[model samples]
Target: MSNSPQKYKTEINFSNDWDISTQDKYIFQFFHQQLEDLEANQLHVHGVKLYKVESSIVVTAILRHSLPKKLLLEQVVLLVKNKDGKELAKKQFDMALFGELEPCTARPWKFLFEEADLLVPLDEIENEMDFEMAFEYYEKVISDFELYLDENWSNGLTVDQQGYVKNLVSSLEPIKVNEISIVGFHFEESEQAVNIFIIIRNAFSQALTIENLPIQLFDATGDIVCKLGFPIGEFQIASKQARPISLSFSKEVFQKENPDFSSWKIEMVPQTL
Candidate 1:
């Protein structure tokens, strides 16, 4: 038999050098630090996403617990930067995600920046790493922005001057009933009268007028135990104020079936507009 030359064939495949797990870890850590910073100021950030559109960059995030009681934030500041550790732009959102928010709820927020708003061209950003580094730089500047708001809230609306005018008008307007609450009651046997204490909260910016307010008391079975009316003749409650009122009722007005006022519930009757 004639000797034959040996023949061999081999196949090779190449894998990407990037580690996806490492990228994920970096993103997670960046967001964790952002959340921690927000928590220090009693705010919460749930999620964030970045997108490049044409000549602009859009940032969408979920904000949680952004508003606190007795404080309203009419504007928010957004800072953008480049991978070279240079600030790119700063934008202001005139309105919040919602006009009003229930406590402990999440709301979606969006911030848009155009080419003119950025310091560098979008093409200069090479990869995800560059974008991430820019966002990291933003984290440090946001705290100063928050402090600026605390001190210059009245001037926060520079771009939209109309907002400032509207705010001024609202502050000068009349107050309205925001909430009504019944505190407790005291029965004066010697005076043959029962004094019911109530707290009325006016959330408006201006004073409110309350006149001839009617209140009713009910028993455990929802039966009418007593009825009384308060003559707050021309009484005006100041803006963002909580005022206490005491209504007196004679013992003769109490129903004989439920004369005891110990287990009674009190409520304010709605007034006709």
Candidate 2:
């Protein structure tokens, strides 16, 4: 009892959001000498406790890294399952929130699996329970912006460029889910014409094909600059996806009362039935 391995900082050991009462603790499983994951991370599940607050199941465990060198992990998926390997709860976590792990060091942390996060209802659980927790790193977590790009663009994007786009998308308003929207982010103005780079999003739950689309361009000051329409027989788009496009407005069509090209938008003009 004299020797216990060094633990990580105590600040990460508990959560302020979990108002778990000490008297409400119930059935739990104790795990030790568990298996090492592919990333050399080992999880020894000390136990799990149940509390009435939010039907939350808080697991107390010691996470250790067996590798010879220090590891810095971020946005890691923590998967929890029963002994039979049926997934019970899953959540993505940033390691920094838990604390540091030097080579071969272990840290104890309490993970709160709230009722809303549980795949299986709490009423279905028996008084006795056991759990296994592991990390899933390969699974991709799509961002709000990543859902906007179609397959072609997602496959060809560079990491840096993709990150840049993701940041830009975060600052913009959430994309409407029921209507089709055209968002223009860039414009290339030449003496001959103004080429607008646009992203068209289909928020409908099913695939859509718009054969003809009439649009009106408006500048930052809310003045109409041009009106154009497209015969888009080939512009078939999948449900809940977006595609990048370019629309050119020739000088003759673009009414330039010295129209500001720095910031502009295009709106889809309603068609008469």
Candidate 3:
């Protein structure tokens, strides 16, 4: 439940249009294909990419082998999900079946979810062409990544990034919230806005209700840059089951006091219920 990945790495590619059931099947099919092509003791997926853009989820990973002539694989699977984890559609296939040749586009594995049924970029050459083999491997796997987003029609929740806070709530390991501050700041000479993001952990599982989650700015010497505070509205959670909440600030207010400020140190100024 902690945001920090206990496993080596896991990335999920998702689209908002499909329901969760369709998404589950897509996952099963995609993994099933990889299981088929993976060579004995040679398959690896220590580092992979997963994300959702619009209505589709795209997954990319690197697979290597101990042999010089090992077959390289690329897989592309399309996915769709609804607001509450419903799956609506899915498509998947391998590149080897496509005439055994890589697509000539700048991105070899190119499939726009809106345009085609599915997209798959994995290609295996019988022999190593040269020392530059890895470059081709990466290009094949990574280049068409943006297509995943360009094809879908719905805007889904950025679940993976937002879920990070949930992990903080589930942490069994102790975390030190060394510092937190929220303050106004100007970015790139643009409009003033909240320049800080503060995450306060309820590691003890005790309910914390702070009335004013202030907009704090820190100076070069680690001093408070401004006295202004954001009106963090009422918060509630009576017991240990509560999850951590987040606070947002305006950029202009933060940057006016500390132009260089990017982060903040927050403290719980206690208030009784």
Candidate 4:
């Protein structure tokens, strides 16, 4: 018979020490140990790729697992350093490696370091960049990776799917107002009705007048026990201020015989206007 070459590749065999319940935990621990070992040896530039886009730098790389077993990843921290051997910036990312990962698998990861993320100017990129050095040293840590620069690259901050870059902002900026919440609440029982006191805080700078606000009360079993609707009545709340409003409901409105007040929850129905 004529000799034939093998077409199928051999399956990877993992050692006994690599047994873990979830792939996320295993990958997290593996990367954590690798990073710790790199830091101990004063080499921090492995598994990282830097691309000098327009004014900002875009980093893209893959975190991989080579073991034969599937693993889970929870979170990982990336550190950026300057040419002076000084730490410049650090960011933590939540990994979505929840399910079982096949052997020799990889996950693509990207991070955008804007002007704010980088404390120093982009022109100052020098040979002392620790991330570059780390990548060179640990080239085998990741499989099939390459780095490229793009002058037309825009900031990845606006990308909603990339949650890691969403929080990258300046420290001096003020917190933006999104919505209002009930700060305090109380209830008083009278002979015929129950008084509901709701204290709301306006987080925005301008006055907010919500009309026909719907509030629902739920019992311990998550059943709607009572519903109340009232208008804010064109109330003007000053910038960064709080206001307390009171409403009353009939005692017969509650459907539960003996509702557990401690376990009850108040739900504010979302309104557009």
Task: Report the lDDT tens digits of candidate 2 across residue range 161-255.
Answer: 66665565555555556667777767788888888767776666788777777888988888999888867677777775656666788779877
- Where in model 4 is the C-alpha error above 4 Å? 1-176, 255-257
TM-score of 2: 0.42
Full-model lDDT for every candidate = 0.50, 0.62, 0.35, 0.49
Worst 10 residues of 3 by lDDT: 141-150
Tell me each candidate's TM-score.
0.35, 0.42, 0.28, 0.36
Residue pairs with backbone overlap in model 2? none
lDDT by residue (1-273, candidate 4, tens digit) is: 856532222222232343535664554445444442111112122334566777777764444454555656555556676545655545555545324446544443566666666756777754323453223121111111111112222232234622322222111123236555552245676777766655454556566666666777776688887877767666555544444566776768776666655555566776533
Highest lDDT scorer: 2
RMSD of 1: 21.5
lDDT of 1: 0.50
Best by TM-score: 2
lDDT per residue for candidate 1 within 159-222, as digits (tens), equals: 4543533333333423334443333333333357666654454554466788877778776677
What is the TM-score of candidate 3? 0.28
Record all residue pairs in model 1 with backbone atoms less than 3 Å apart, i.e. clashing: none
Q: Write the per-residue lDDT of candidate 3 for residues 1-273, one digit (tens) a residue.
A: 667523222122332333446666564446434432332233233213334444443444333333323243455343433334333334554645322222110111222232233232212111111111011121121111010111121133265644543443344333323222122212222364434433343323345555555444555556654545545566433323322333444554443454454443434333321
